[model samples]
Target: MVELNEVFETNTMIRDENLDVRTITMGIGLLDCCDSDVDILCDNIYKKITAVAKDLVKIGDEIGIDYGIPIINKRISVTPISLVGASSCRTRNDFVKIAETLERAACNVGVNFLGGYSALVQKGMSAADRLLIESIPYALANTEHICSSVSLASTKTGIDMDAVKLMGRVIKETAEATKDRDSIGCAKLVVFCNPADDNPFMAGAFHGVTETDTVINVGVSGPGVVKNAISKVKGQNFEVLCETVKKTAFKVTRVGQLVAKEASRRLNVPFGIVDLSLAPTPAIGDSIADIIQEMGVEYVGAPGTTAALAILNDQVKKGGVMASSYVGGLSGAFIPVSEDRSMAYAAEIGALSIDKLEAMTCVCSVGLDMIPIPGDTPAETISGIIADEMAIGMVNQKTTAVRLIPVIGKKAGETVEFGGLLGNSTIMPVNKYGCKDFIDRGGRIPAPIHSFKN
Candidate 1:
């Protein structure tokens, strides 16, 4: 099955095209760690996560060395903390204490991040869910590696406007709490509609109840590889262009498949899916927007951007499905504003707006990610933004999420640097129109009629 030419092609992609495995995430269930006492519960969670993921970083580094393919991050996801800590947590401080324990465990294991400090309240919130949501700002401010997410909408169940409103205030508080650090705490928090349980990405990843005790999932990144392939067929027709992208995606995903299998075998954990998401970084030439421009769009937010993105997302799934039998977890293109250099430039120049980003999310993987807005922006306005995005995912039955940062004391056109993978962003302007009355009448938005398939 090994061919010399194919091997050479892969080597070229790695050396020049920014092709790499984005993450090797270990999903560890934490339901068994629950107890009736907060201290005991946190201790059990710490022990379980450390015991299961003790060797994750070592194995990830060893695999990268042996295979000569870069593995960017090693992370962990546990069961949603709300479910596991509900009976034990008496107050918001109890949740904060648990967050501290998670931070320690992540540091001890040497992982880049730890997720599942989350609550799933798509339709309604329990008493425990409210405590967790209220404590998010403080929890995130106190911990460095702990990430938080709250699910407020789904297709089967309607959007929880109450939770959406609460999240708006929570996000504002999170920004204020971390203002000294350029509001970095909000960067680690995500709001989701139809969130995926098996996602290998940060801020939105959790081990669903359906999963086993342990599993290994991989996320692949290759915007540069796809863009390079598109350049070769510059003057070709649509058929040729689509074929080129599909073939390039096949090669990129094969690398992820190989890494996933090897990591699972070495760790003695069951292999999960390969998430073929085109996750970009702050590095130039490795942007999803560049891939769109290669498809003939003048710029990222131009007229034909959405159409080009639709093609890229569809063909990537087509190619990825053929490369690996298990392709899941938001397996498409991601267009986070701060993480992608070109997208951030577009926003800085006023070429992109929040409305255009929302339109693009209808076809892309995640939505409205890493966007910075003015500090004085109203909480109702943020809730309106989340409501609109949730409507899109609910109607289309696709996953959409929001990670907005209301940078305290920052205005539009001003830059805030978050450093590292989060990069920097210029705060974008939002509509001044008020939607307080609309958000004040809080109730669930009814599910779509198409959800009656049963």
Candidate 2:
């Protein structure tokens, strides 16, 4: 049992340290709502989502009030639309209709964003998957609350070069469609390799086909809290630094554990897991980069940065896992450049670069996350980048994702403001050299030799 007294001690963390629950995501299964009739499918989906998530926002708010834990966003995830709408969807437009329906449900239920406008074709693509992936640009651009993701690779199934190549075009198209909004549609579209079924974070969350009918997963953010703890032991040895991060992570996860349990019990939905990722915000004093800097690195891309990130990520998992009964998702330190001000600044001044960011993802929770690059970045180049990240996740047997917004009409070194938690981004330069030849060799990368463990 968690010491209830420890929960009250978080008042300081909440008030001063920018500690808050990032999101309370309710994952609703929609397989039962699938239908051969497109209209019926859309209706069934909207009805099911609205009915199941009717009280989601209210309950989430109440939990925040009751526990003095500021729950920032209430969101939802559903079964991957490629599978859920397979019986009904024949064309790309049909999938767009479902995306519109999902937007309606999210608006009615008052959630900030609803995920699972997604496809899972890590090995190969079915006709439905192809249609869904093709429709992503329009689906995301037309809907404000709907987010889309496509899984292009996985550990067991190797990399799907076709999907990787396709997503490059899709991402570019999404940017073009939403160019007026600083290519924000691409902000809501992420491509993943080995995505988590119960991730409460956005841009890549989907209710897996393996999940129950309904579930609640919460992602907790406390970068400032951890940073403050580390600051207390300034000039301390490595042993003290690791212990501080671990102990702070334990307390932070307990807070999430308490909130998740309460939300589940109140809504009569099973509690899924607590994702104790030190997800940062645009606010000052709340940055994963700051935590790394505190550890020793002068800047994020400097030497020894990856080692610091590795220590922070591992210690967070070790301590967070022990605090909650079930700990899952991409639980570690998030390094989204846009969301974390320090990271964005690092890129702005050339203290960070795309190549260094790719290397850092080897130790971080998510890969190449929320990075905005030049508008003129070639689609094949984007595919090359995705292929590289997928290769890392494939060989490492871990979840990695890419949310690159090739900001339309924007040049490198320019800034685009997304505001809110999405924050501002300094458009980073992509490699000018073309990768069309490499990307055009369209065949899957086979799974690593060690994947035959079964």
Candidate 1 clashes: the total is: 0
lDDT values, one for every candidate: 0.93, 0.93
**lDDT (tens digit, per residue) of candidate 1 on 52-95:** 89999999999999999999999999899899889899799999
Least accurate stretch of 10 residues (summed lDDT) in model 2? 1-10
Maximum-TM-score candidate: 1
Off by over 4 Å in 1: none
Once fitted onto the true fold, the runs of candidate 2 whose alpha carbons sit more than 4 angstroms away are 1-8
Roughly what TM-score does model 2 have, to 2 decimal places?
A: 0.98
Candidate 2: Cα lDDT at 77: 98
What total of clashing residue pairs does each candidate reach?
0, 0
| Candidate 2 whole-model C-alpha lDDT, 0 to 1 | 0.93
Q: What's model 1's TM-score?
A: 0.99
